[model samples]
Target chain A: MTNQHQEPLSAMLDDELTNNELTQALDSIKDNQQSVQTFGRYALIGDVLRKEQELVSDDSFANSIQAAIADIELPMVDQLETENVASIAKHPKWYQRASQKVVQLSEHKLLKGSAQFAIAASVALVAVVGVSNMNPGQDKITSPVLNPVPLVQGLSPVSLSSDSFKEKPTANQVTQSRINALMADHNQQLRATDDKEELEKEDKKIEQ
Target chain B: MRILFLLITCFVYSTSAAATGTATATASTKVVAPESEQLQSKEQQVQSEPQPQSEAQPQQATTPNGEKINAAYWLKKLQEALTKSNFEAGIVTLKGEKTESYQWTHGFKVNDDGTEVEIERVSPLIGNGITAIRKNQTLSFFESNKEPYSISGVSIRNFIPAIFYKDFGDLVDSYQFVLVSKSQIAGRSAQLIRVESVTKEAYNFWVWIDVISGLPLRMAYIDEQGEVVEQVLMTHLSYLTEPNEEINKLFEIQLPQVANTAIAMNQQTNNWQLEYTPNGFELLKSDRHHVSINREVADYYLFSDGLVEYSVYVQRPIESFNSPLVLKDGGTSFVMVHADGFDVTVVGMLPTETAFKIAKSVKSK
Candidate 1:
């Protein structure tokens, strides 16, 4: 079977075959691993050419298509040949290099001008925002003077005490205890006055 | 960031310090009243005296006919005399803590419409010397300073009794009446009757009745501590007559020019009503009048028993520098309150408590 498939595939490869014979050879190679690898190389070359056509039309589309093609698993020889062609295409011949350098210099000049414009725009935006934040609603606006100390710091202690007092009866108990002490003192004074009066009455009775 | 934090801390410290300082100040101040003891002594003197020895002996006062002089008989006689007497008196009211005096000559006339009209001439005893004359449907203030300010509402007769008769029977009901020793009042020997309220909160009253005419000569109100709160002495009373030349002259005095503006304002905005008052206290006449100074409208309702006249004033709150509640000039007290939608001011020689209650009860719609 392998020998029979090779005769037709070689014929098809030499272009000495009909379309039917070539389709048959291609079908037979689908099940044969070594023939399938050779067929894959031919398909890759076609794919590269189709991709190159799409790339020349739209640059973004071309970059995406190229990235997709680069991700494919090509045979070792094809991969080596593609890389060599890509390097040659990047480095060009001496005359082409000179023309490419000229084009690159012009692009560099345009890019530099755009970059300067972008930088200036960004600087202007920052300055506007900074000035607005610094001085809002001019004429009637008054600048806020920053205090030296945090306002909340002095309030924290009293707030803590008030919160604690609300949670318990300690403050009320203290007030009630003070009231009890004063009442007790008043009672003592009244009792002492009564005792002194009684003693004075007893002395007057004895003298009588 | 450091400055911001410092500012916040300083603000907190100052606020807390202020709060603590207020608390400390409130705590540290000790009120000392050097004259309190002296006032108490004076109050004791007024209360403890005139304690009738007969209170201990209840059976001694029974007549030979065996009819006990009961509370009902005394109250009935007092009410009858009050209803019948053609009593009139010139009154002076002193507002509490105020230096100004308001003198008004008040008289009551029973109108043909079965209502009573009380005429009051409010004359300033001191500066500007303006007299505000009020008659039924006619109000004129005689003032050298401005135009004779005038506006008309209800008459003074409908206004006075509404103020004087709040809980009219309350004094008779709350107190135990005792016919005490005789006293001289208004140059006549009078029967002194002591009416003490059963409750400690009640103020006692001493009413002197004329021995021959049985008319009330004077009435004295004593506070809870038996301090004399006020005294009303009825003298120089004359029966009502047709409008005389002298009466016309008295009513013709105009209010001061400054007061004309106030009277006009007062005439524009006062609505007052009284629901129920005792019998014999008839609304003689009512009038709307303008007050010059504050430009307020006043409704004066006058009521009388052919004798004693009372006036109730419904107007805007009179702006006063001193006590707004008590306007006492001369011997009378004018109790004023801002209530409902209007300022209620009732001035008379009646007890201050009665005046206050009446002023407070005035409902404005």
Candidate 2:
């Protein structure tokens, strides 16, 4: 449900809310994600109205909030629908640019990490291996390179570390990736076979 | 009132390591006795031609004390004694610079109709190890964020000395076990057995078995460079032939409810026809699954010298790491290779050379 606090948020944004109502909204927003997001949106709305997105300078606060919400799943991007992405001619491309930027920024947390991107690129690797295997005389160097820029991958499950990732020697990287791929495959199969976790409940007959 | 917001990563179930608990046994470790035999006839037999089917399960060999026990009997007995004998051992696992200390206990009781199956527990004496309680077929893991659930298996956790679960005779295809040396381990009569690869060029393993109890006291995986890559050493040992009242009471226990889901059926494996596997090695399991991309299915094949198990993985094109890589961590080693768009890797408790050889042996057929 949409909050009825739009008026109160506007009042707070205008510095016109009563001390008591302002205190209540501030307190309530702390316990609710939607309310906090609403406050952020209200702040953004204030920025646009003041016609000073640069001067408002909520970037640091937004960054901290982004970090805090990094673990939470975000909404999907509807802006990248094929037609919109395919459009070569659209005047005042403000929406397209804004949506694309948002997608680039949030893809890490909202979608699976660069592993997802790697899968998309590696389909070409499949063709490369298949074609080369069939024809010994085929030019090995003719294989296409899908991902030239290696994406940053995190060690721990936090933010992708700021360090730039360099794709190692193609042979070595493929071999290591093969090891990881197989090990992960082994575990996934094992999990498929044995990984059901269920809660223990009372009043049910269970054999020892 | 002033507001104070505490931000915490509230994902309680992130770590899925089935609680690996370890405890140290109280028996003192003793000095190794002497070399019974090392580089020997076992390798010769592996290199020899046919007509050895009769001598395959040889049991004529005797220890210094005139006790008749060959590699097969000793290995089978070791597995049986571990599960049947009521005992506890303090274990220390070493891999490179890291060491983990833990204790493992096994016990059982007999009632009217059937014997109360062996009850076992492995707990780490230090650090946050998963504590596992095994009563009969149920293994329940108790650890943080891991909702207690039971799975039916001989071992819920991996650190059970590998030799305790395998048959050396079965390993005759990949490894040759010969009487190597006598080592006093855990203040007991310990016999060292050299398990060499049939290929002669791959990694070898040494096992120290308690002479009296017939239990494996220690296992060491030796690399081609003559360095100990990984090892599980028993520092203390104790065995109970007969159950006492206190032990019986302990056996009468309650365990977590087993999960209601269907047990994981074994997945199908790819029979990647590799030509050059060392003798004594057997195909343990095979499974095929997608790696990064579902369309690019990868083949995983497990090969075992009975005790030391390794997996050979093969997948093709679609961008993966390209160069040869070797990694050694804890008790496992990994070797990788990329060629002709096919990426292959071998991982197990073997030396880097052994894994490297295995990885290189993967032919497209």
Candidate 3:
């Protein structure tokens, strides 16, 4: 029923409606509460696109919207639909109520467009930072420097102190990095050796 | 009468250990008194005699006329206490200038089907550090923000040396056992047993076993000059009759499965050979693989003299460190030497001089 009046309602906000059409749109909006809300939303969208004001009103904007959604009287809507379905034989009240719920849920969240915009902004920022940090020349020089192994590493509580020593920039980065790598590998080798020993013992037990 | 009683007890405990599959009683028979051989069946009856479970029992048994008892007996008791007792201990490991505290707990529980479960844990007393837990044969490590990993081993090699869990007879070839004077630790009387290296190449290990509970109270690595290079002291110990509530809760925790894909025994013929190894030190394994931390290929060799083990790594010559760079943390010495065509590094709980000698001995085949 509102589809016939949808054009005049939009044209009225765009200032392209004739005098007669504007008066009819005002009358329809005054009669229908849904039309009044649609008109207010259209006007806000127009103002935002034209750079009239900020999109979010306050810090608790999302919170307030969530609270409003929570306060919606779901039971009252269910009771009204059941009563309508019992009396009227035209459209099924259950279908109408289900459609109304979907509309209300989407309208109250107001997340579709805003979430996309946030994601786009983050992606662009990451691109800028990543491009700034990339150094292809340094990577080529350092890739050939392989770590020398340290044979046994006893992973202990005191190992943290040695780890901190590696964080400091030394005159020989290559040597220091190699030593760190070897020391860590040494501890790993010890654990692996223990593992191998355990497996062999198990195998011997099976043989016995 | 006292000697007869001691002999009967040792015979019973050794046979029970063998029967329970805890420790092999192969060398145990050799260490027992000759008279214990005849008292084997008689000792089985003494098991029900409410075997002296008092704190004053061991001290009374070991003093004066008890001098005939060997260190192997005390070591056997130590192994039994470690595996069978339900106790919690506060441990502090002194290494170099640092001291790390840990909460050590062990529980031996028996299932309804006659199967036994051994749960042991060593967790740092302070900061978020690696916490080791051993359930049966699986030794697991739980670290902060990292996946807990499990390796197959009978004991958690933390403050306590791994040798303590194994057969003490294995060290008979390389080390001599000596019974020292009685010492007090944490208000409890302890029996000191000193294990000296035969060749004097490895550090001497001294352990003080709690006379009553048979648990280790203090263990130290003593140098040639009788100076303690590193030590693990039991700050306090609580001997429990059954697993505590915490250990019972831990019993229900399903540990991660032991990963079978750990660096397998990849025996490869290495081109480098160690020309001079200390007496009794034999190569345990050798392989050429990419190191876990730095994907660098290295010819690695692990050597052990039963009590102590060391690793040798030979890699392609890199930027050398002042010919031989030697560093020591407690009893462990890290020695890196620049060789003819390759760089060699020797790391283990051995003396610096010994480590350096081993590092320099690496020669190309």
Candidate 4:
């Protein structure tokens, strides 16, 4: 009922009380019915408080507070870097540092690209050899593998254009453009397939 | 080999979403209107029939013998029955992924302003007791969580009696009501009514009212596909003589010092029109809410006919937004759909199909 007993009682209810305080509160509750009822009320209040705190907090209390501060700090930091980068880019020296960072990020991708090319070349060599070894009746099986020759030929011209954009475009703008293009191309492919299926269905119905 | 690997990856990704209840396997199922020629013929037949008002009015308002019953006569009778009744019941609400169950007893008391304060003792299935005491212009939620939070400028006075009876006169401007059919609920005969939106943007609701007692037994919201999205039912009812003092005292108790901080930085606002709501559904009131931290402009729209009440929330967008689930229990499915910079979440005990339909119909302005 009083603040002295209630402080430890409330903390004990929240499981935040030190061992000594918890023992004292428990002893007090056992001795007096009023303290027992008060403790029950305190426990209920603590449970509700914990639930509400859980609802509002995105992560752990410490993590969420840190995250909120980081969020506030991040934009200011980015803005400072942008202004510095702009001024440095206008000068000849700082451009080198920026270019170096960009190169480091793309280094693994460049290595992966070369490895893919090597794999594709080996597959093509095997396909050509297999086609030569096959009997006359198996020509139909090799015909589909030969179709990728045209697609591989088409990639060279687009990669050349992409290389130019990669050199000059800002990272954010490049990312946004890439996302837009990928979404647009996917939508186009879906439309084409839908149209093809509709036409095929109509033709099948006509035959029936 | 690469194609096989890609196919396996795609299968895994698709199945994972289906397992979590986040994505539906049948989402891509196209709704094809059964050959437009048939629909056009049906439309012509519908247009040729007598006006809905002329056909529906006589059958609904009148008894089996066909005598006109004025709206005022039914409304008064409903008010009297609700005021006189002493009721205690257990209610449960399940909205996508959340369920809240509570037992409550309802009683009326006259305030200083002469308006009645319908006091409800809400003992939650989990956590402390909640006393919701509402009089004209004031709505207070006294929870064990903290100090009592009070909101003024209330339009609706009572939660139960207002929603129990169809008092549509106050809500005529906001909704259009149609008596759908007669159905049985909780072993009693009831009238089913459909409340649809007059405005294109609002959601619609269907409610079942007990015929003899004029009490609401069940309520459902219909989705765009004409499916019930969510439903809440009031099942067992009994009358209690002694007020549950333990529950009442829970409301009177003030919040402890440690829990003085805010649960949410700002009150969330829900803005949408309601179409085809029952006769009793009224826009009881509106209030401006201010918060200490992350303060933003917001409004709360409270609606009740005489019994059932729901709060419509509207607020400014929060960065890195997460949808709030008030409660989740049972097999009820709750869903939050985000599109065009607006997030609409539907929570109720309705079927998943119904919840999905309502979620899809919410269009961001």
Candidate 5:
């Protein structure tokens, strides 16, 4: 059904309406089912526009290819245009040559080539970084501290296990585990205490 | 004379109701004096009209007659602002040199049928850590590596302290609320209030509340020497007049089912007792369960003075570290002591000395 009050509904969603207009818009939208749906659609569109990053996944490589294709205006008579493009390829500038090449390549072939290049580049970069990280003479590097030190004083961070076990020669692994477990449980208990009380109140309400 | 007497009694009832701090009760009690049904209904409607107009309440009235507002009133206002205001804030938590940024959004909406809904979300600005989103009473935690789960709660216990969401009245016995001067925070004027421990058993909490919106602009934990141990600063805030588009979309999201299994079913009894808890500290809960991380069985007891809380664990003695090991992390102090046959550990946002004392007080009962 066509809604006569769609303008106010969208305006209310955009927060552009005055207080008096907002109340009037809300009052009208409440009675109309189509207007409510339109309001929801307007809100969803606004959210999509504002939080585009949050909604889209981290697939930038594919996005770049799609964006490149969008920038190239594909002709309606593609096969016929390709025949004409070959005949008119004389005296092309370097940039125009690159653009024409991109336009000539099919979309699938271009995507596959980009994907292969991205994978090979990432693999090469990983190899170089991994080799440097595995340097043999780096004696200063200890087993990367399994348990992150939660505390830091001024500049230096002192971990619970290392600081407390420095003087004692005994293996403090068990002690470290105990300390971590207790600390974790303490935080968990604090977080859950409020939930428990709320649950108990809900249970009481259900019982009553 | 009879009409005047009725008016006086009605005035007395209304004042007493206000003293009790219940607005609806005051409105209902005002109707008792009205003789005619029509007048009573109209009076009730007029009185209830102001209830929904909390936003229209003059901000200056918070500090009446140029007199400083009570700290508890500011805390109540903070709670109201956190729950009711439709705002998006960028908050950064500072602990030593480590800083973590978060995007916090809270919105309140009312449906056409008069049902109220609240949506609050906190997401880390950098990493894919836990993003907590609370829709009404169900709080859902979204993480990249784990399945999302939901729990029932009024607030998201993230960077903000849980005490801010709870009733400030519970802290009256333990904390001394002091109103400090106003300061500029995030370019907005803020009223500073300190919630200090009455018995010096916990770290003092200072909150700088935005004067206009009542939202917390900055909050810090100060030690005995008045050094800030850690702080959360609101970098910026956008207070919306109504629920924003993101908040409206959150209403449409179907949060995971409430994981009732997460709550401990039975309160397990422990064979240990703390002989020397702080003055206002009350036992919150005690249970015996395998520590989720290490799988070690330990008896645990939690104590809270409303503002801060501490957890005590009594586990079997282990011979790894020297006795009486203490560590301080930001505002949290961890104290562990190896007593005879058993070990006592106290973890909380209390001073190390207070935590040590509590850890030492754990005796077999």
Candidate 6:
């Protein structure tokens, strides 16, 4: 369950791994669903680390690659006909590889220039995904990630967030009923804004 | 060639979404208005609007400062276009994976005395005749149900955000507005205004207004990470000079029977008060409802900052043993916490931190 291979996946994305190591990492991503998903997550982490927020990522990309991998016995490294892989491989495009690594390195320099975002990758990642997958009693995972790095000012810290929580019935649905009662109150507020008379009443409250 | 391109694109973007936080917006939906029936479909959308109590106050049409293009100006334009103009627009609302298309029309009639009345109707483009109409404060429902009742409101409360119709100054303390960019939407030049929060970075709003009409063409709610969570885009827009005969006739159209119910008030108040609330957001109302003869009483307080709103509920702690809980759906956040012998739930589109803070703030009054 641990994301132990993220560093390797990170290196593989940068085209830095030796040929044998690259082959092994790609094979792991091809065979293991979790590895593929983790690689996808790492690629995203790399993008954030690189500060390339303009490029749009495709969510279905990993799934499509996984599905293709399940169907094809041959590895995808040789199937990249669109890329000049054969000639590049024959000529050892040393400058292309070096310049690309330099760009990735400069991405690190760009990240380094903003000391505020030095801890951006790990802290912000959990905040983004943790906000979506938040669950109670899971503070062990969500809380520790946010403790050290105080979020940017003007932004409040989310101590608790969950996608959905299934209440373990407590005192005959008292929790759920209270939640519904609040929404019912909100419904009244929604109606109040649309009613001119009620609005005047609110305006009077604000004036007072 | 397509597969080759797809494979390359896939590898290039697949893992990169996590880092950049920019996911491709789904393909833009296209709705073409048939030239003959766009506004002529008075049989559907063209009606009058909500209560006219506020319409009596008429300000100068445009300021003498030569059209100050600030947030206040655009908001004023939006309000004017909504209430002053007669038009039909095709609206598409996208929230998460849910998309709904609806037809909206507004018609205004000014009497000789100078007071204006409006008729408005909204019906989903695909449905079994679920339509809502507002004719001077009586919002009548026209569903297939045997009995239809009218509600007291200035306008139909759905389809459009409630904040758009209100004065923009109230929201000043909560959000700062900066005109962001100019783009084309619904075949019209659009100006985008970025409405980011002053206190919380959890959510923001982008409102795209039509430059000519000053009407909102599109609006979206984005999270702090620069991702649009919910949005509404107008597909077709047409302004009318005068109300058509059908819309004029709707002024006297028969409405469903009004419901007979007295407003009830529950007197029970929990020993609770909110410790902190964002500026300009005030308590609109407090209500107490007893589920079982006042034994399991829940107190509700609703708060709003003009355009954005959230609610707080306080009641006795549930038997379940757990820490604080937070959940999000679409643009809204729901938080639950245990405080001062009460289990509280704060629900609205506010950030989880704000909601949780409000939830835990309930204390003995």
Query: Which candidate comes out best when scored by DockQ?
Result: 5
Which candidate wins on lDDT?
5
Clashes of each: 81, 45, 4, 43, 0, 13
Tens-digit per-residue lDDT, B1-365, candidate 6: 32222111011112221211111100000011222333322322211112113221112233233322466666777777776656677899875556789888777766679766778888889876567777766778777764666776666656566777766776777788886655766445566888777766347888997654566889898877788877888888765545655457766677775565745667556457789886667877677865332345668777777676787777777766464866666677778787867778788877677778787777878
TM-score of chain A of 2: 0.27
Span of 10 residues, lowest total lDDT, candidate 4 chain A: A121-130
TM-score of 5: 0.60
Candidate 3 lDDT, tens digit per residue, A140-159?
Answer: 22221111132345642223
For each candidate, what's the DockQ? 0.01, 0.09, 0.14, 0.01, 0.28, 0.14
**Tens digits of lDDT, candidate 5, A109-169:** 2222322322322222222222222334543344332112423557532354344445444
Residue B157 lDDT in candidate 2: 45
Ranking by TM-score: 5, 3, 6, 2, 4, 1
Query: Which residue runs of candidate 5 sit more than 4 Å off their true CA positions?
Result: A1-171, A199-208, B1-69, B110-114, B262-266
Write one digit per residue (lDDT tens) for candidate 2, span B1-365: 11111111111121212111110010111101101111222222223223223321223322333332465556665666676666667888986667888878776665678655667888788987677788776778777677776776564344553445544455666667777645555455466778777675556778787644566788887776667777888877655434444456557667878776863434754445677675566675576755643335768776655555677777664454435756657546666677566777776766666678778877765
Error of 2 at B28 (Å): 17
Q: What range of 10 consecutive residues in model 1 chain B has the weakest lDDT sum? A: B5-14
Docking verdict class for candidate 4 = incorrect
lDDT of 2 by residue, A96-123 (tens): 4434434443332222332232222122
Model 5 chain B lowest lDDT segment of ten: B8-17
Q: Which stretches of candidate 2 lie over 4 Å from their true place?
A: A1-208, B1-77, B112-114, B155-157, B161-163, B241-250, B256-272, B290-297, B316-320, B363-365
lDDT (tens digit, per residue) of candidate 5 on B159-252? 7787787777778788878888766665555779988888777888999987556779899999889999889999888765455677888877
Give lDDT tens digits, candidate 1, residues A6-113. Answer: 566445434466556555554665455565444333333333464521112445533443343333232312322232222322233422433333233223222323
Give the TM-score, chain B only, in order for the candidates: 0.36, 0.69, 0.81, 0.47, 0.80, 0.73
Off by over 4 Å in 1: A1-208, B1-167, B170-179, B193-205, B211-216, B234-365
| lDDT (Cα, tens digit) per residue for candidate 1, span B1-365 | 32221111001111111122122111111111112233432333233233323131322332333322543344344443333322233333222223334444444445578675545555666778556666643545567867675544222221122212122353443456676765555444456777665543234666775433344556666656566655555543332212233444554554333322321212333355665333344564455654333334457665443323345667554333122355333224455566755566665434456557666767765
Report how far off residue B36 is in candidate 6 (Å): 23
Instruction: Return the interface RMSD of the candidates, in order shown, one decimal each.
Output: 28.7, 7.8, 3.9, 23.8, 2.9, 5.3
What is the Cα-based lDDT of residue A111 in candidate 3?
A: 27
**A61 in model 2: Cα distance from truth in Å?**
20
Docking model 5 quality class: acceptable
How closely does chain A match the true chain A in each prediction, as TM-score? 0.22, 0.27, 0.29, 0.24, 0.25, 0.26
